[model samples]
Target: MNVFLGFLYVLKIILSSVASIFLMIAIYLLKKLDVFHINLRMLIMHALLCIFVNNIIQMLRFAISLSQNIKCSSHNQFPAPFCAFLCINGVFICMERLYATFNFSKYENENFSYFLAKIYAVLWMILTLCSLLKFWEGILPGRYNNSLNCELQMIRENPLKTQWHLILTLLFFW
Candidate 1:
């Protein structure tokens, strides 16, 4: 089981890194060529940013799980970093989808240049702030597994907080 988990962790890291690199390259190439008109470029840029954020979240989650299992420094690293990533990505996902649904007619009526750019910038800033604040609460030191591991307490011990998160995420996604 340990070996399997280790393999999965490695694979997850590699895949996330590769995807990030690919997305970066795609964005660079698109910008360099200047081939696409304004509307298409805006859409492509939005997609690229979304993909980058999602893969970063996946990488952070994998790191947290592995660090916990190996009894590393989960307090200073795991909960905060992982939670920050989750919060940021979650907000982005929600905002992007919301914009598409709420402002679909705007895009259809006119070019997406102004609207897309503004929404993307606003979403990124909001996500950054939300993630930093939410995860910062778990920055204090704590012990786990009979002091063998010092980390933020598990979600199981704080079901109320976890349940709220689950519900909020569900609502955002749904």
Candidate 2:
């Protein structure tokens, strides 16, 4: 089990790093070429960059923890909040895309630029709020187990909330 977990961790780190790199390159090209004329596209790219940063931070914190093994710090202090941001951002994007699909004609009729801008703003505010949830009450530093692994905790700390969020995320994808 330990070996499997270790392998998973290594894979997670590698994949995250590679994703971050590709995302960064894409963002760079977008900015350099001025390809994205739409406000929504720019915001989506910005959110992608945010996730990229989140993944890099997670990888760094995990590496730091593995190397330092500092006894002073608790577990959740490492990468919990950013991890939560990643999950929330993902769900928010998925939900937004769903909404966009359903509201296609409405989006086309109205000035979609401002509409997208509003969604982008609201989604980012929600992401900020979700990330702060950890600082407020969601974080449980001492509890390190399968019930609260790094990925699961990204959704939320409350088991019921986590379960609901997971279901909702899956439904949104569907």
Distance (Å) between predicted and true CA of 140, model 1?
Answer: 8.1
Error of 2 at 1 (Å): 9.1
TM-score of each: 0.51, 0.51
What do the candidate models score in CA lDDT, each in turn?
Answer: 0.57, 0.55
* Regions of model 2 farther than 4 Å from truth: 68-126, 135-140, 146-174
Residue by residue across 11-89, what tens digits does model 1's lDDT show?
Answer: 8789899988999889888777868655666656655665576677657756765776643323332233333434554
Clashing pairs in 2: none
Best-matching candidate per lDDT = 1
Residue 150 miss distance in model 1 (angstroms): 22
> Per-residue CA lDDT of candidate 2, range 95-135, in tens?
55676789877754443566666765776676667656643
- lDDT for position 95 in model 2: 59
